[model samples]
Target: MVSKSSPHKSALKEKEGISQPESIGKNSVAQIIQFRKQQPSAQELIDGILKGDKISLSRAITLVESTQPKHLEKANEIIQACLPYSNNSVRIGITGVPGVGKSTFIEAFGRFLTAFGKKVAVLAVDPSSTISHGSILGDKTRMEELVKDENAYIRPSASGETLGGVARKTRETIILCEACGFDTIIIETVGVGQSETAVHSMVDFFLLLKISGAGDELQGIKRGIMEMADAIVINKADGDNIKKARMAKTEFNRALHLFPPKSSGWQPKVTTCSAITHDGIAEIWEMISEYLILTKDNGYFSERRKDQNQHWLLETINEQLKNHFFEHPEIKNLLEENKKAVHDNEISPFAAASILLEKYFR
Candidate 1:
């Protein structure tokens, strides 16, 4: 049906044809895969951290958080090398109940510090998810400005199996931050509770953030966290809430009198500020500055650090022992059986636990 010339040339082929894009090169794919598998040496990480490199600091923290024995061993070497350069910064612990503007206040506070040329590092311990076993708020996403600031570094870690508000490796992480030339280290807890106790042990200053409420509620708690706080900062003190915040501050001040005098000889202070409006932020810093001057003059600062080191020594031992007992293969199998027996009341809960402990010992 076609002429010989038409069959070879065809008018349809004379029109413009669509062009296909080039395919991905195999070499590029191999290079990307190779980059993913590459890990920097511990000494390289240490050098980069000392030179104020954020990328290296982040990689080292990830190494510390890893569960692998090799990663842990590398993390230990990094920590040991960095230890000599740490403990030079002021460690501040910030804790509050949910919806109390902990993140907002911390952002404002951190911005204030960074504005004055202080390198700030915020360690935010996020609540762990029950289903995924991961962090609920990873990477300090709530503090947008602070997260973007060059002088401010924020690292969010999952609470994991650590019972307190902070992570198990948080103490070690602090050493790295200080080594990276951060003058102010801020730790934000998941929420205000038993976690406050854990944070109190590690920090030079413990600031409890609270929203304006009825004066009666402030006075309801006579001791506990109220005693541990070096300062109770009433946040959201703008416009309509200013009057109420003043009332709460006065109430908190009166309640603070009930606790015994601190060994540091510095009295607790109550102050109010607005994280939104950035009001009264400087005064809060001034109060903390005064505290530092007082504590340092009396030598309580160094003494307290010594005490914290001893406390951590014992805590690390307890943590390791508990992990060892719970992680053993034999213990894991026996624990499940004991749990079933205890549930069905075939054996008393205490006896079942004793048998498991005995087996673990055996």
Candidate 2:
């Protein structure tokens, strides 16, 4: 009673007179502004991306793909803000056998789609050398016409030892492209065996390209890939291979029937096309649209996307965990020692892995 009111009054006055923690707050704001100045503002870049500004989109993709810690934080913030504006674009993954002419197909398909007034973004994932960690970066040169098209945006990325011929950053790059308002996104994966499954997980539709007369169609690809594809296009079908292409298409069509139907409740189709002459490109696009309509009507379209998101989350977590494990100095030493042990036959491969894992947990 004697001091309660007095103390409260004094405290209020002291609080009003005292300086606050403005220095830290001011520094943070200044840092954010500086970071923004160093990188493109997400909102501004996103706006340009939506308007089909190729330069802005390229810059935005590069910002997202940057390895700088600060740039990564900004990229995350931008993606978070742009998430609501995303998911409006169609994502298609295209893969083929090494000589199946994936680059040619993408160029022809991209030009065809743009001709219909749709903006297309092509993201090519090139295989990186395990020894040098460098990529050939050849997509732009292969798709010269599409690269020059104002309505088409082409970005080539290195897989960097990642599985599935897709970059670890490809998913994030896809989000940036969608946020920027690309109507369609085409992910072109390096024609690696079995690893093509990675691209299958991210796309709304998976199209596999195979050249006719490559021996038995099944010989050219694993059965697992054939099962995963929504559509199979026998490429190089224009010249002397037309008959063989048709025969190959029939073989695939028959093979497709043996597998259990997709969980998406849609049947996969097989077709033939020649990417070099641009023959049957329009038909392939039409089939894609038809598939979309059928899936959307059946309520499988959104469900498929949700499933892809879940798969991506798991993939991202596993990738990060692997990176962290390999980067730890102690783990690196252990791995090196284990490799030597295996090479010298001092330990079985399984035992070596077990020893390393035991130490990893410690």
Q: Each model's C-alpha lDDT?
A: 0.88, 0.83
Candidate 2 structure quality by residue, lDDT tens digits, 1-362: 57765644443443556665776587888998897677567777767766657677778677777767666776777677767878998999998768789999899999999998988999998888989989899999999999988788899988766676664588888887887768899999888765578888788999988877777666535788878889999988987889999999988888888889887788998888888888899899999999999999998999888988888888878877786777778889999998999999999999988887788888
Clashing pairs in 2: 50-180
Candidate 1 lands at a TM-score of 0.89
The number of the candidate with the highest lDDT is: 1
Model 2, CA-based lDDT: 0.83
What TM-scores do the predictions have?
0.89, 0.81
Off by over 4 Å in 2: 1-38, 41-52, 218-221, 329-362
Find the 10 residues in a row with the least total lDDT in model 1.
Answer: 13-22
Q: Return the top candidate by TM-score.
A: 1
Residue lDDT tens for model 1, 1-362 = 77777747655643468543334367767788899899999999999999999999999999988777789899999999999999999999998888889889999999999998999999998888768887666447789999999999999888886776464588888999999999999999877457788988899999988888734445546378888889989999999999999988888888888789999999999999999999999999999999999999999999999999999999888877787898889999999998998888899989988998898888
